[model samples]
Target: MPSLRSIRSRIRSVKNTRQITKAMEMVASAKMRKAQQRVLDTRPYAEKIYELMHRIASREKAWSSPFFETRPVQTIGVLLVSTDRGLCGAINANLFRSLVRFMKERPGVRFEFVTIGRKGRDFIRRSGFNLTGVIQGVKDRGTIEEILPATQLVIEEFSEKKNWQEAWIFYTQFESIMSQKPRHEKLLPIDPEVLTGSGNPPNGHSGEYLYEPDRRDILDVLIPRYFETVIFQRVLENFASEYSARMVAMKNATANAKEVIYGLTLTYNKLRQANITKEISEISSGAEAISQG
Candidate 1:
């Protein structure tokens, strides 16, 4: 048991905490709606561009884009995408765990990382990973200027033959508000099947596709667009995932705060009741004394 004053203070403190959590919950909810819409809207464009690119590649037998060819794995590039801020649930932790596992799986594979956010960059730097490139301050929505540089950096690295065989991007794919799956995808060497929809055994093609121009010429332009579209899609998914995680985190915090308030209210009631009991006892004793006197 504690004094009334102490219990009052505890209740007041919890009240303030509850207010803050409630505000955060509202903000996260609002942001989640916007992010979810953005992810849904951008997906179709990215998919269409990829499909067109595949159709072109599938039509050409001798397309010689560096992006289409595979090479020996001398060096690996890891592009890690994470939120710039914290207060999200286990989003970053899950991404980090997957990253660590990826590293462990390729012990002898020399790797360089391209980090997208401050969180991932800081983590890579602190862990002393060979971080080759970092792009920070990417907006929540997809922006061409913001992503173009990073895409170009990787494309140039491949075109220049920096001894990098493959590039992988790690991101949280937005499945639903309650579910986000950490995904590791090969970004380069654009899977011909992903483009042509042939790689998927279940695609069951209707017929051979038609081409607007020479398939090789179309591929020359489409490969870079493919990279851009993939990056844009990733940015959208990351935003949706961040908002979903934040919303869930704030909701939990709000619930915990409410529980704390309930406990404090119980304690406050008990302390006030004890005070009333003591005061009643004192008054009754005084009345008895007066009567006796």
Candidate 2:
């Protein structure tokens, strides 16, 4: 058993830690609510754009868009999305693991990375993976205009340089407060079935489609918008995932700190009681001895 002073010190330290974790938890919760709302607001737009793109890509008529083109796999581009800061549980770890597995599955393909967050950039740089591009300091709830440069970089890398045949993005999907799943998705050549999912609504029929200038002109506009929308949606989702994971992690830390304080308090009480009992016994013994003397 330790001294009362030592136990009290530990209790005080833990109390301070608990207070810090509790405050962090509250901040994360507030950020999570905003991120969640943004995600929900954009889902409809994302789904519709994906549906429209899927219908066009799935047709046998054969669109000549480079985005839909399938080429020989020699080089692979990866867009790794991670939080700029830590204390977000294993959200980024899950993404890294998925990327590792993907690399293992496809041996001999040269992989280059475009990292959105500082963490991903550091990881890629440290791991000796070729870093083609990096865009950091992307704010939460960032606008499409702000995110467009990174999108353009990836697109140009694929189209202009033709260095990468296929590209994928890794992010954590915010399913719920307690549940965030790491998502690994192919960004290009776009997968048709993934876009359509279970198919579109009744109004999504080809007959309802109308071209303002021409079909080709519509596609030219739609393709870039598709990329922008998808990237923006993922960014928002990662924000929600980051905050949710942080909130849960901080909540756990606070709870564990409280438990530690409770245990220490219990031990301190026992030790103090034992000391008081010993003092009373000593006093009683002394009184009896003096009386006898």
Candidate 3:
């Protein structure tokens, strides 16, 4: 059994750890709220742009646009969005696992990575993949400008005929406070079928729309803007997921620390009682000896 002093010291240490974890949990909670709100606020615009782009691409003339062109899949450009920091449970782990699974599914296809956070960048480096671009140190409430460089990198790579034939993005989609899932989405070659809801227009709107100036000119601007919006929305989702995961992880840590403190306090009390009992017994023995003497 450990000494009472050592047990007391351990209890104090655990209490301090619990305080830190509790503080982190609170901070994560506040950030999570803001991140979640941002995701919610921007989702409508993202969806509408996606719908509009799909409507345009549904036209036969829209196929002439480079953004609508599909080629044989040989090499793919992958954009991975991850949290900048750690202590967020298995969020990053799940993303990497999904990436590994995706790679396994496409055995012969080559991938060039573009990372949005330090964790993803480090993973690409460790995995010995070709990292084309990196955007790091983005804030919790990051703006589109912060991510524009990586977006442009992906766009430029896809635009070149000799480069990647496909571009995909991997991110954690925020479902709720307790649920976040890693999502793999096609970022380029805009799948009109997928986005247009399988031939059904969104909200039952007839796909008859007149473009201002000309259709080609409108798509030239709309397609890129739509792509950027999608990327930005995904980033916002990742931010929310990061905060949610961190909040839950810290909450669990705080609770576990409390359990440790409780168990240690119980042990300390038991040890101290035993010591007091022993001392009382020793004193009684001495008293009896003196009386007998």
Best by lDDT: 3
Against the true structure, what is each candidate's TM-score? 0.88, 0.92, 0.93
lDDT of 3: 0.88
Root-mean-square deviation of every model: 2.8, 2.4, 2.0
Residue-level lDDT tens digits of model 1 in 141-176: 557678887898788776785657888889989999
- Candidates in descending lDDT order: 3, 2, 1
Residue 219 error for model 1, in Å?
2.1
- Local distance difference test scores for all models: 0.81, 0.87, 0.88
TM for candidate 2 is 0.92
Question: Which segments of candidate 3 are over 4 A away from where they belong?
Answer: 196-209
Error of 3 at 231 (Å): 0.7
- What is residue 23's positional error in candidate 3, in angstroms? 0.6
| Pairs that clash in candidate 3 | none
Candidate 3 lDDT tens digits, 1-293: 99999999999999999999899999999999999999999999997887767666665543465677888999999999998999998999999999999999998999999999899999999989999888877777778888888778888899855488889999999999999999988878777777555556555655457768887787778877887889999999999999999999999999999999999999999999999999999999999999999
Candidate 2: list runs displaced more than 4 Å: 193-210
lDDT of 2 by residue, 204-279 (tens): 4553356689878987898889889988898889999999999999999999999999999999999999999999
Best by TM-score: 3
